[model samples]
Target chain A: MKYKSQKVAYWFFAFSMLLLILQIIYGFIMAFAHLGYDNLHPVIAFNTARAVHTNLLVVWLLSGFMGAAYYIIPEEAEYELVNVKLAYIQLITLALVGVTAVIGYHFNYWEGRKFLEIPRPLDWLVVANVLTFLGIILTTLFKGKKRTTTSLVLTMGLVFAALLYLPGMIWFDNQTMDSFFRWWVVHLWVEGVWELIMGGILAFLLIKITGVDREVIEKWLYVIVGLTFISGILGTGHHYYYIGVGKVWLIVGGIFSALEPLAFLAMALFAIAMYRKGEKKHPNKIALSWTLGTAIVSFVGAGLLGLAHTLPQVNMYTHGTLVTAMHGHLAFWGAYGMIVLAFISYSLPNLTGRKLYDSNRGVLAFWLSNIGMLGMTVAFGVAGVAQVYLERRVGLEFGDVQKEIQVHFLILIICATMFTTGIGLFIAEFIRYGQPTDEALIAATDHDA
Target chain B: MLSKSQAKVFFLGGTMVTFVIFLGLSWNSLSKEVPKRTHEENLTAQVVAGKHIWEKNNCMGCHTILGEGAYYAPELTKVYERRGEAYIKVALMTKTPWQPRGRQMVAYGMSDKDASDVVAFLKWIGEIDLNGFPPKPDLKK
Candidate 1:
């Protein structure tokens, strides 16, 4: 909490990452726990495990965004965060809130939505925390003399990410109305506002690490955000297709969500253009690769599968099956989630003043985490396709369907194990890399700000 | 002027080839009408009523049919073939139900009429030409 000259943002990013690790562990456990018989499920049943996993992921991703925001916003604005202590308090409070929500979830006090599982009370606290965090960032961005252009895009994204939570609270009496409002939070956040955040973060990272011209970076950010909102807002229709909505929503959601990936592809091209057109050799090359990789992979996994499922005809075959789960797992982890992880990786070593991450071991850790997740994505998608065949096309019982893909389940289990081990390697590498050097400790003692 | 025009024609030819490749892909994935089913007027009312029960109860959230919705229970499209409509109705409404071992359909908390309606709905679907698609997931014994 008390680091000198370093923006205290990295702590929040690291803390968020710890929560992500917990989520992967739980996801693995839930997969195995499905091998139950009769009308019996463990106390930490599938529903309960899922609630905690998804909600924790949301909180952690927010932490990552806030932490990254704290780091980049100040630097982008060419100033320090207005009240660093208040930001620290917000981080601690968020950690506490995460604990409460997870405990409450085990007792079945949860909303039934897939990812939006926090109870009403927790949601209120989270919303307030969000406002406070965003407030600090905005005030910091306010009154800066030579602010970089990326600051505006980052601020725009954070504000919307907070503001978009409004529609989620307004549920109606009927399920149809409820479903419509529910997706305003869920679908819009992922497709709409989250993309904006990812765009801002990626652009900022590129400009900072690649030393791209401010004008070019700003133009890229504008195009990315413009494309995000246009494609994303309409993309919300994809979820509406099966939720007892009218027929027109199908056309709207299908086309819009399907079109959303083009923006991401554009983002990748922009990143490459920035790198190719760089002036200075960037100090931290890993960070640059991570920032660009997150954008491209997210487009490939989340955006592509989202397109597949958005089509009313294709969704007719893939809806609510393991195929959906496959898409969600990859998209959620790779897109916005990976961007957050990248921020954590980039910020932690810098904050600690430890020259530990620029090493072979650290590089291997990054590769393993990326490759493990890729394997998990492939296994999950393949297994889901197999499941679509067995359960939907072929007449097989649900329990029997599980038996049919015992092989797939095993492969997914292996994939999850690999992903988990990869996470372990990341945590280990981060710990080793974040260890403060003797020189840094001596300097810290002498130069306590 | 002749050289540029010739180049334009070549470019158009390449674009045409690329467009055909793209269309060939999308043609397979694009939406199409469900091949006409043998709809029986006698059972349409029953099936429609059963659809009501399904919608009312939020059963699709837990069960799937022809590759749609949640995957908690066996699909109902071929229920009429596996178990006669009479048996399906009985199983749906049976007060003393057997424990679902392997892929078994649970006894829905339904009355006799509700069960009959569902049976009618399943029979209607069972009568359809499956085309070349595989059989529906069933309550395997």
Candidate 2:
């Protein structure tokens, strides 16, 4: 916000919000469809709705990550963005490609590869878009007065993520080969590089919100990064347990992915320890809540829940059941989703010079969304366990098990309503803050002083 | 308790080790593990074309191949063996939407050629040695 070029991030964040709302709508469509109200089945269909839901979640999270980079890189590197116009162009092209791909899903014009479902042609466009994004970030960082570990880690994550996408794009005639390479993009991303992004953003937020020195904060970032690499890299084996991979993966995946929780646990402890040590006088209490919530919740959602089924013995039963869905919902929400909200909470006021940080709606949004998502996780867990027992254990039909689990969708719908309401309030507060302005830039600097 | 400089070196070393290990494991899988199961000679032109047809239609979005997709529908990994090629073709060719009491499967309105090719792709996948995944538990025990 101190720099004029940073205003471009506001548009990116806005686009992220737009996509999030669309993602939730798709979530509702599937939730209702699960409840036997397949009214939209003819139009949207379950598979198409699911594709849109998951793809939108990924797109919105990426957009948020891009926005976070734009805002954080300039401030951390002590320079303005290299080319604001190119960043804007990148944002528009990203949106166009995302919309086109989502539309293509409805018409059944996409690759069957989950998460990498965007057609190969559009995948090329995504590569170009991300390269432009990384170009702006890297150029600005190198040209600036300082290149902190925080900015470097975030940039590394973005760069590695772009590189990983290439493996998924490679054409493999063998389904096993295709599935194997696909995880290089999917698993390596959430468990590997994205953790670095989370660390960078979390470190930046803790330093600002806790009044902690950069040295202490950046030191913790290293530990998180260390633990992340130690466990997350081999954690890719976890997904290979049932795939047409070698039997060695059964042990490699279990042992390594089981240890993946340590990184998240360290993150939780790091944030809490930092909070306890520093002066808690940062006036933005809501931002502080979100920052702490993200750390603790990620440990629970990603670490603990991921560990729940990471072992080969347990995963043998829950590989693709609602059990996986249960873990996926919480892990993504706790780690990526909440972290984005924390970044927005911290940056929104500075960007707009609005002190709407202490609003009831803001606090309510945090609690309701989190509590709602937790409820959704529990419902999915119960349904998933039942599914494992009935279908896998008792040898009932897949269709029959789904019928038995129909009651859980009612609970899911209720929880989703609460989650959606909280998100709505957060978006409302965002809109009320109005757009970034020149006056707000001066105000932000004065507030910093 | 470590200094910032020490922490940096420590993390850098750790990252390198992890990356190297990952690369080694991936290389091993490609070279040793996959070759044991992959019959390159079996992957005919028709199967390759069918794989394209499968990708073009986004079958994995609903039906899991080798237990790696949405579980709303049944696992299609062994569907060719379970239901046979003719049954799968008839199911795919049936224009009437197979709206089961539970999760519904949309008819892609696929042509006979496309349906047959997809079946071929499934058959090709079924032939691979999967290391006994989707392990069957004895209920009586």
Candidate 3:
């Protein structure tokens, strides 16, 4: 128990949070440059900023999640991490690869797809980390005294996510084929394997916090897993609809993606039910609020907006617009962003063994982020819809329409700044004063049983 | 967290309701939209040959006709409207490659015939009469 989980994990989580901070800052800058139909600064163009926003978001979240996994998996398995050396290596490898990939993107050495940013060689490095992490998890799972179903599901989700990523990165002579495969990575994981991770991790965390009966939570877990894959595979169809695919795809994507939200909804309901039915109360009220809020927003950001564009008719208007960005910013930030943050909050105290981590600051960050996200989503969505009306229906020049939407884009910039300040506050709390008082620790412990 | 009994019923109801709504929406989409291929209807053998070249080259990789390909390149659905067949053919064959920002297709060094083929292919896709096929170009990108 003494070997270092919390302190070590905080560093990695902090590392990733730093990347996320960069992502939001760059995202705001880009939004501003595009604001008011004129470039605020042409030097850091919209395209360049977008590249930074997306890459930072992905890498940052992964780093935080990896840190959390090392701590949680060991405890759940009731053993030390199977390979501490390999975990360090994994972190080093990830850091090196991420840096190189960002540089590569800046220099335009990309494969030209949005999500599949790292070119092949660095991609190989990423794959290596994934496999090593998977190996560690597997060894621990098989060797452990406890083999919880939740841990198994989470490990498998990680494995499958890596599996999906591999095919998408392969080089193809055929551009269309390459593009098709590229989306398989981005869409498949977010809509597919990653959701399994979300479900399993959320389920495990809920149990620790709420002391919900394991049997009841386990049953709900199965439903979540089932719906995740069922709806997820079909969710890929939504991207397919516009990609030189036939009408059959539209039908398939629309139906399946529509079904995808149900899994999200299930997760929300399950979390709420557990909270309501809890015997022991959660000690970390702020952590619990974040977890709960994260779940609800995941349903809204990933589910509702997702459903809006799954319809071919609606996608006709919204497909490439800021509407898509509107959905992506919220969905990614809400679902993965909050899930990983919850992990950081939950594991930080235990790892650091520092009592008196202020839970209120985390709560403040949560609400601020949620508010900023809502503002961006609403403002951009309205702009996108108005754009569709002007250019598509009323026949205005697309350039003119771009100018028109710049005003709303500015609002997005302001909201993003607010969100960034909130994240900074959370990070400060995380670093300087995260170890909670003894009373809180005892409560967290009592709540677990 | 539902009572073991209560959870099962709630889960079942949620799943069934979601499935039904999705199915209903999909069915409605398929029934409502019908596509007419009138644009590809009147095509010359040369244009058809050009289309074949396009298919063989997988031009969609770099050039998106109607918001469908890799964004690394530009949208080509409006290409004919922007530059017509002659300019398209000449540009494709003529190596006016801007070294700093070279295109993905430029390296393939397409022949005049190949350029014509891609032009034809772009024209063919651009002419689809589906009500919502070509979405408005997204500025957010």
Candidate 4:
């Protein structure tokens, strides 16, 4: 909290958490619906719940990323945000657009695309909102005394993300063509640019928490992101494999997507190596747990689990089944969801000037949420495998296979309860920290971070 | 033994090369391969309207078309071939929730024209060359 403008990040993070709670509620709605309890089918409906669940996830993660940039950019670049008022305005408009889209889903006013479901008109508002955010960030970064690789990487990821959103917005009468470009936004963002954002944030956190040399960390950061693009950019082919594309993708996607895991493996190893190499250990044990947890878990969820089915041979059987859901839950949770929580855990003390770092609740929240998510992942895995075998392999009807797997949703629900409780505890701790203050600002040399 | 500058170059050079290749492949796919495979001639106005109806209702949220949507219902990519137009129309044009087995689908209660449009869209999707996707059940007795 060296700069007064940094306080805006707290609000963004808070708003993100609020949406997260809402996102979890919708997830439960779908899980129960899977268990044959479509009691709310008329009201929330599976489709509406599904849209809200995923859209909230995208919005909340974006909000978290924005918060991370606001917090990190100032400290790294040695300047305040160029326009704090405009940043807040951007945040408000972001929320309004997000809320309007979610409400519209209930009333059947949406584009109905998988991830890019926000209607066209509101998409323009999102474009405007993100531009405002980027404008403030870029201006502040360039105007400041320094331009570290860390900040450059974060800003680059943000800019590329905004640019990539265009392809999804393009009008295409062909469903195949429409889906072709949609992945340019959805898959590319998560697997491609979003990893860059994750790497930048991870590098920044490692430098701060471990007192590692910035030069050493940034060097590895480059190699890791290099691997990400080398593999991830073309890794978009995996989504194209069955989407009315040419046979060229079957080979390209299988090969490159298999290589995609290497980036996550590198990331996981890089973080662990950095932690062990550095002598200084910041006392924020919970943040350290989350930081380390994200790296390792992402490797398992995104890397290994992804490899499990990414090969064309395996995917042919598991293409549209719950197996994709299994991979999706963990990949997003590990790579994006956990990283946001990790950044929040790291920054909260600095923002609020409250050193409530190593409480039992914090540790419990970390393990419970993680274990719960792991359980849910396994539940999805078992059910997805069964669905593939019964429906795709044995040729059972889709509905009959779903009935056979109905019990797994019960397990999913119980595990989701655990995951939700962990998040609830995390939120409770967030509230307990209260708001940021100018008094929290400390001299650059004197601060622990 | 890579220096910081070399690492930067690696990141920049790799990204540039891969992005170019990706663009080239995408252009070829769109301009040449996709039209041939998807029978661009068959994509009638009714099919386009059905695509609109599919999106308007967010049908992908539950039923996967081209194996790309939620898995709540069966994949509808080949629905027209598998279940004929009348069945799909009954489900879509039904005024109440279309419950198959036990799972409930939002009853759009669509007009006959709208239902047929979606059927057309599904038919168009069904004909696309997917390179052996939705593979035949290997273990089926």
Which candidate ranks first by lDDT, i.e. highest?
4
What ranges in model 1 sit over 4 Å off?
A: A1-6, A35-40, A146-148, A435-449, B1-141
A1-449: candidate 4 lDDT, tens digit per residue: 38888999999999999999999999999999999888998889899999999999999999999999999999999899999999999999999999999999999999889999999999999999999999999999989999999999999999999999999999899999999999999999999999999999999999999888999999999999999999999989999898887988888899999999999999999999999998987889999999999999999999999999999989888899999999999999999999999999998988888989999999999999999999999999999999999988898999999999999999999999999999999999999999998777663233344
Best by TM-score: 4
The candidate scoring highest on DockQ is 4
Clashing pairs in 1: A395-B135, A395-B136, A395-B137, A396-B137
Compute each candidate's TM-score over C-alphas.
0.76, 0.97, 0.80, 0.99
lDDT of 2 by residue, A1-449 (tens): 37878888888899999999999999999888877888888889778888999999999999999999999999998899999999999999999999999999999888888888999899999999999999999999989999999999999999999999999999998888889999999998999899999999999898888878889999889988888988998888998877776888888888999899999999999999999888756888888898999899999999999999989888888877888889899999999998888998888888898889899999999999999999999999999999888877777767888899989999999999999999999999889989987677656863333
Candidate 3 lDDT, tens digit per residue, B35-126? 22233334556655665465343344334444543323345666676668887776667665432132213434577667777787556556
Candidate 1, residues A1-449, lDDT tens digits: the string is 22342355767867876898888866775566444332334355455566667777888888888878887776666666788789889889889888998887766566554456576688899899989998898888886555654676667768877877876765333333445567667876887677767877887777666777667777666666666666776666676565444455567667777788887787778878888898776656567657777877787778787676677777765666777777887788778777986776666555666655466665675677777777777776776787777766674655666776656656677767776766677677677666434344234321112
In model 3, which runs have C-alpha deviations exceeding 4 angstroms?
A1-7, A36-43, A357-360, A434-449, B1-76, B82-132, B135-141
What is the DockQ score of candidate 3, to 2 decimals? 0.12
**Runs of candidate 4 exceeding 4 Å displacement:** A443-449
Query: Taking the tens digit of each residue's C-alpha lDDT, what string does model 3 give over A247-345?
Result: 676777778888988988988998999999988876677678778877899999998888877787788766655677778878997789989888777
User: Over all chains combined, what TM-score does candidate 1 have?
Assistant: 0.76
Minimal lDDT window, size 10, model 1 chain A: A440-449
Give the TM-score, chain B only, in order for the candidates.
Answer: 0.59, 0.89, 0.56, 0.97
Order of quality (lDDT):
4, 2, 3, 1
User: Where does the lowest 10-residue lDDT sum fall in candidate 3 chain A?
Assistant: A36-45
Task: For model 4, state the Cα shift of residue B29 in Å.
Answer: 0.9
